[model samples]
Target: MLPNYLCYVNSVLVYRSGGTNRLTGLMLAAGTLALLLVGPSVIQYLPVMVVAALIFVLGIDLAKEALWDTIGRVSREEYITIVIIVFVMTGWDFVVGILAGIVFACLFFVLQASRGRNTIRAIFDGSIARSTVRRHITQRRFLEQVGTQTQILKLQGFLFFGTINSVEDLIRRALDIAAWQRNPIRFMIVDFSLVSGLDFSAAEAFTRLQRLLEAKDVVLVFCGLQPDSAVGIALRSVDLWADNGVRLEVFANLNEALEWSENEYLRGMYASGWASARAFGRAMTGAGESGIEAARTFSGASGSDMGAHKPSTGSGAIPGLEAAGLDIPDSKGRQPAFVLDSGFENSPRRSHLQQAVRMALERTGGDAMMVGALNSVPEIEPENASSSASDAEAGLEGSERERTERRTASSGEQLPPNALPQPGDGQHQSHNQTAIQQRKRKLVQPAPLLTLTFKAYAQEDLGQEFFANLAPYFTKVRISKGQKLWERGDESDGLYLIEKGILKARYDFPQEEFEINEAMLAGTIAGELSFLSGQVRNTAVHAELDCVLWKLDGTNLDRMQMERPARDFSTFFRMLLRVTEEEQECLMSYLVTRLS
Candidate 1:
């Protein structure tokens, strides 16, 4: 025992100390010496079971503490991870099991991230208040049509191969629906704001979608993308589907992406002359802008350029066909006959005749003057006769001026100085009496401004008289079926009163379908959403049939405020407010009924 103590101190603790261990060694040596000298019968009295029982109880306490009660609170994937570690450690090698658990958790995490959620939240118009870009009225109408044709897919969660299928399916379905509705899509916007990460596989899906859309002549746009986001990095790493003649645009937000898409669509239409869209672009798309630039670029180099001058030639000479350029020697020419022979019997060929006629018209002076059947040039005989005719024309002109002056003075209620007659003349007395009677009639009864359906929507104090007075300020518009009157997100510039025909109010949803909100019949007031709330339009109104509507915009309101008396204008304004409230109530009730 004393030797064992010395070995333990030297090999284990490794410190030069001779305190309790040395004393214990001395005691054990003495005890062993005494036992050898006296007796060894007392060694069998120790209780080994009690010590084993105590060890077992301590192990039970540690096991109970290790089995945490909150295991169920974790995710199933985490539970699987825990189970793997525990099972392997209990049944196999501890280090190997730990390594296996780490690998399993990493794999599971990757799988979970790849299966993230992606969805669409909303779809709206580019004309919305925040997306204000200048456009012509026709261009705006086209944009409204584009709003119906554009599909916006607002995505949520991570983007990977597993989620890309669902996203692509949504787009495909939307496309199919558009085609079925006879309104094929022109643009598709994918908003990836909720995406947390991205990989090459998902980027490939976007490329595939772009190819499919391009085949249908549709442009694809990516929006709500973070610059350094995982998806952004993956997309950038792959050169972002920029190859293979397929083009796409990426934007930081939805509104910007929509604006860019609209601009691109407008330019494409202008360049291609599709649907004769160049007329709208020419007026709305300003000089040096996208629409005009596209037109100029595609219109070809033969067109006139800013500083390029046309080749000059003598009045009767054809430009670029001068004698020197034609290389015909003057010595051999008898001033060539200029006869254009067409191989036609009796009459020249159509094109040849047109060319000969054009050349004759281009000749200077009266050498080749051609006149139509209805137009004749009368010949003047001699100089004296022409002078006599000129004198007669001067006399007629003087009489016409005198009549015009008389009419002007009569309208102004002031007799011209030269037209004044002597006092008490019978003719003068009669003229004065007639003028006074006419002025009296005009002052007593003014003509009506404009005729409208004055019988509709009138209430207390707001009757035929009210509408008659208001009718002059409103403008009338007629829209055909399937034509959009105004779109959601259009400026709150006016209110409308449907005079005839039916109108449908619709809203675009995230699901890429329009929900018909209500049917607006004659007498129904539209645009109350803007008129009352002072916000942009939240719904679009389209003509269900040929509709006649009376429009009242701010210009009309300004005119009312200016031309009408203050008391009358204020009263009319208040009545309009009341009408707006009633219209809103009607709309709300319609919605409630439809929803219920």
Candidate 2:
């Protein structure tokens, strides 16, 4: 067997030296046949010393190639292995050397794989790494504040028995640190996108880790795994979801998993905030005071208690009456029935509570100036009008006073005693009536809804003038939940700005067997890439919730350019460009973080 292996090495050398065909094998066979036919006579005619010298030269060549030429070409460990194998083959048995080589290789591989840093590609907390989903401003702010509760471990390479221990230790250390800080981790996201494979032993290790996380009341979210993949199948074989009732959460991609974790975290936080607010409201309304017990009973009887009787008007109604264990009385006083309007028809229960709290504060003589800071109900002012009619009246009075002073200065005129008009003066009455009519017109005009979307995105207020000019170019569009705005490969007709609700864009790569999903919140623009590049859509967008969108097509933009002033159109175009640039920057930063 040892001689056969040496012969194989010599055949490889022959192939490297231009004998790369069946001709070499055929010639060798022919020589063997000739030797068999001619017997020992032909071999006796050949020079024995010459044959011996040829064999000696080939042996030296093979030895030099293996021992000296490979010295600088391979790593120190590999070179040492080679030397050891060569010495053992020379001094002992060839089989012993081969077995020794195999053992050393396995040991080296295990040592390299077990290194802690090599298994984890990157580690991120919620603050530095977030999902592609854009959320509301308040939700986004809250996530940033408590981002540390969610931890992400982006794992790479193969996971086997040796390497899995390092991953477990790293997670345990992170958990310990979090517990020490009094802000324990709530969600642990393990991203397996870059992982090539995993062994059954590694999968079992993860099951143990799951138990640890469950004991701590932490959720373990697995992402970037395909159900049909080997790693996924291996993981499924384990008792990941034991009879203890904790379910394992798995997502198709990292973005979706992260979004789910974030939503869960926010839901708990918001619920706690609501509970606190409810307690404060109860205290303020004197629900706990013994002296006010009778008053409370009387108010309850008079239907002044929240949700006791539906208010005829939209104002002063407590939001989420059912959630608060209260019911509004119907006309028959048997069933509960109520409706909320004043632009909060589709608002969440949180928004309703916020509005109710703001109204309560107003009635209790809370600071009006601090209302905006506390996420209070927005003042019922028109979007196009910066201030209310009362403000407009104040401005009119100031202008009238200035006019009187100007007339006195310019004409150098003094009012005669007869010039002092009585209450029935027609000129004064006409002027007063005209001013009142002007104020009424301002109050009655409906505001542009698209202005809300613009104000949310813009860093500073662009003012009513900008919105007034831009509004004409955009047409309002409403879509029901699950309705697709456009399919992939559709013509790039326009971009849609989300005014309300959520839009989800999914990019599917059939060949890759994975999809990238992103959520677009209100105030964000969708399909901007195709709109700007004049290309077909790469992603299909659908309404995740009932959505209100403002769309601007190329035709509308061109019309604006033709009909409006150059400066006005230019300003609008520049604003769009700025928003696109800002979004691109954010995406670039996110990609860098993930890739790094």
Candidate 3:
């Protein structure tokens, strides 16, 4: 056995002289067979000195290549290993030395592979590395505010028992900080896109991580796992991809995983914000049982019911308020003269009204504009009440009459029957009839202009002047729920301004499945990229709910440039540019996060 091992080693060394080619190995085997067949007869004629000199030369050459040539080329540890193996072969046995070398090679490889610190490439939160899905400005701001709640750890290189501990320690420290801050981490995303492989021990470490995250009520999300890949198989073997509700989620890519986490964050925020808003409304109303009802009514009307009413046309009235049973007048009309009626004196409801007003002012972030409205509430006098009523009755406009009625309703007063248009009075009856018909017409007519006072537009400091000038360029387009607005690669025709409802933009590629890239909310601009640049659409847009949009096509834009003042056209163009800039920045951020 010893002789056979030596023979095998000699053949390998001879093969090395031929640059390790298969043909050279074959020739060496044939030569060795021939030499063995005739060895006894040939050896007697050969000079023993010649054999010794050839062996000496071979040893010298091998030593020069292994020991001398490797001095500065290999690591110090590896160089030392080579020296130890050579010393063992010289002092002890060659077989023992070869075994020791194998052991050392493995030990060093394990030590180098298990350096876990480099395994985690980076850590990010929602603020810096957001999902590809674009949301409304307000929703984006909210995500930024609570970005720390979602932690992402991007991992790379080989993962084993030694390296996984570092990842676990990092997550534990993050969890500890979150607990201390009273904002526990909601989702911990472990991205394995760059990971080359992971061992069973590393898989078990992830299992332990899962248990810890579950105990802390945090979700464990895994992304970038190919189903047939070794890492994925190892993780799956540990039941990490089990159908556990809320505890674990797996996605194909980081973007999908991020989008899922973000959606969860937003959903929670919406629920909590609604609860807070309801509580605020109840406190303001100051009617224990009725306060709850009022809160519910206010929240529902302001939120989901906003789209129920038709948009106002030049009325400046909040469309849904009347439907919500709040009898407020149009903005163009005069303010209701709130006279101090007999019923209002020393009324308990007055204090509640004051509290409501004060609370509203506070909620508005204590804007100075509302301070005057708060102070003047108690100073309402009845001195000019009779004159105002008389004026309202004597052919005052229909909107004025409506305002008076709303004011009287709040004051718990009723107008005398004679105060209403008398049946026998021809002029008053005709005028009253005309007013009623006009009110009906306003309700049925489609609003000719977008309301600049909408929170989204108001944020841009747009006012009536901007609305009046730009509104004419937009044509209203209504889309039903589930209707597709445009498909990917479609020619860019125009940009859309969302007046009401939600639209979602989805990206689809031949290599990947479709994913929703953005949610276009009311008052946001959509398709601006393709519209402005004249490029083919990259995403398909569809209505998430019944939608009302104002579309501005190239034709109208060209007309506006020709007919409108340069300032107006420039202002509108700047707004489009700003929207494009914001979208680009968001896209760039997502791409950077993904690549990094």
Candidate 4:
């Protein structure tokens, strides 16, 4: 075969061999056999210089095909790598060059990670700043103010020595600014919810940061750490942070840690102050003036010469406390409950931190004063007086009561088609009491009721009246042990309020096994999210034990509106409107939380 013809045959065979072409294979084999037979004679006629030229041209073609297209797009570092590999391969060996290239790539990766861009997205107080999750576990106004005194540094990406160094500078600058502004921070929250990883070196940097902050009497809290994350590993391995005076706490999530920090600030800042308020209240009886008036006068003395010592006219005046206008008394002869009435009904009005400060000042012999801007306390009307009266009037109606009793008796164990159990139901009395007790225990150390959560959505007084009046509309449900009360992705049929026994919520994911998300005790409401949003259930709930539940749905509610007495139905309708309003708030909270 001619040299060009042989080359063409070789390339064709290489390309076509990949397919299932038996004919091509046979032809190639026959051609090769023919070449073997005629090769010596043909080669004898061919010139050696021509063969050399063909080989040289083929090498050039291969080189251009491999390298030319890549040259322009390559980075400077890649250029250096290519040069090094070429030199090493030529001077030493291909194997050595490949190994060297691998090492260079690894080194580049480490260097890039060390010098990566800033991961911090924000640094602000939860009190003034909104988070992606609109709700927090804690809902105390004091906690909100404490949030202002705490700094949340939301970080993203990975944490390493170099990145941690950058973080240190950021924190130091924040501290300096706080000092200059005269609003020194008491807590520093390092939020790592968005972080991809954390190295040991970064953990060490945090230790150093803790030490630095400790000197300034600041507490450092690390939040949103997963159990298996790198920083979590480092922190778990060392107990140095737990040693005396370190004050380092790690939390499973940002919200939990922030709540803890807020609680700490609240307790620490106001413990003594509360004692002082009580003492001041006690001393007022001897001064011949009402305690509330004395406090107001002391608070209103802001323009007085605060620096100079003034004679006491038995007014129980506290010096320099009048500037802030802190009021703690109500018309009712109850313990001074600080209420901030901003006139905006929808807003969360009072700051408990301010009240704590007032108490703290009084303890330190500083005048507890109220500022002029805060002098006008907003009038808070009784929340449910009219509703209570209406309900009471309807209860006294003998005919309606007799009709409800007959409905209850006839239904016997199964509820009437459209009716629910009323609060006065004899059968549910014990279960309801048990649920109430469980709820009361939770109240002792109240979970920071997320203003965005169910508890927050239900105003205490309104919720009490609403559920009481509306309870008659919910059908009683009994679930057996291990039985599924509901499943994830099920339709939003109704809301279940547990009256007795325990239930558990679990989450099931596509690629992962089921996980136990939470345990529901009596009095907890399940399916609130789904019921409000008209969305499918996001979790599955199973009865941990035999459970008694009150299930409320639209069908039953509508039936009551048509068949029930007008007075009772009107009260329930008002409650339904309130519940809808609260659910809307919850839905907004849910949406914002997801986006954040």
| Best candidate according to lDDT | 2
User: Where does candidate 3 clash, by residue pair?
Assistant: none
lDDT measured at residue 431 in model 4 versus the true structure, 0 to 100? 59
Compared with the true structure, the alpha-carbon lDDT of candidate 1 equals 0.49
Model 4, global lDDT: 0.50
TM-scores of the candidates in the order shown? 0.39, 0.64, 0.63, 0.48
Kindly list the per-residue Cα lDDT of model 2 for residues 254-273, writing each as its tens digit.
77676666655433322333
The C-alpha RMSD of each candidate to the native structure, in angstroms, is 23.2, 12.6, 13.6, 17.9
Q: Rate residue 360 of model 3 by lDDT.
A: 43
lDDT of 4 by residue, 472-494 (tens): 56676889988998888889898
User: Where in model 1 is the C-alpha error above 4 Å?
Assistant: 1-72, 118-146, 156-158, 175-184, 192-197, 224-233, 241-244, 263-563, 566-568, 571-596
Tens-digit per-residue lDDT, 1-596, candidate 3: 12123454476457656647778767878977998987778778889997666566666766787889998999977987898898877778888898889899888777765666588998887778887554444345445655666788999988987788788888888768545355446678889989999999999988998898887667788898877888889988888766543357777888777766665543332222233323332222221322122223223223222122222434323333322112211112422112223454343323332333344434332211110011111211268645433333342344345576688889988888566545356756676666544432211102112321122323354433355456567777989988999999999999887655667788776757434366655545789889889899999999876776778898998999999989767776775686677677877887788778
The parts of candidate 4 lying over 4 Å away from their true place are 1-68, 88-96, 118-159, 176-199, 223-230, 236-245, 258-596
Deviating ranges (above 4 Å) for candidate 2: 1-26, 45-47, 116-118, 136-149, 176-186, 211-218, 226-229, 274-451, 456-474, 508-514, 532-536, 553-571, 585-596
lDDT of 4 at 370: 22
Candidate numbers sorted by TM-score from highest down = 2, 3, 4, 1
| lDDT of prediction 3 | 0.59
Give, for candidate 2, the lowest lDDT window spanning 10 residues.
368-377
Instruction: Give each model's whole-structure lDDT.
Output: 0.49, 0.60, 0.59, 0.50
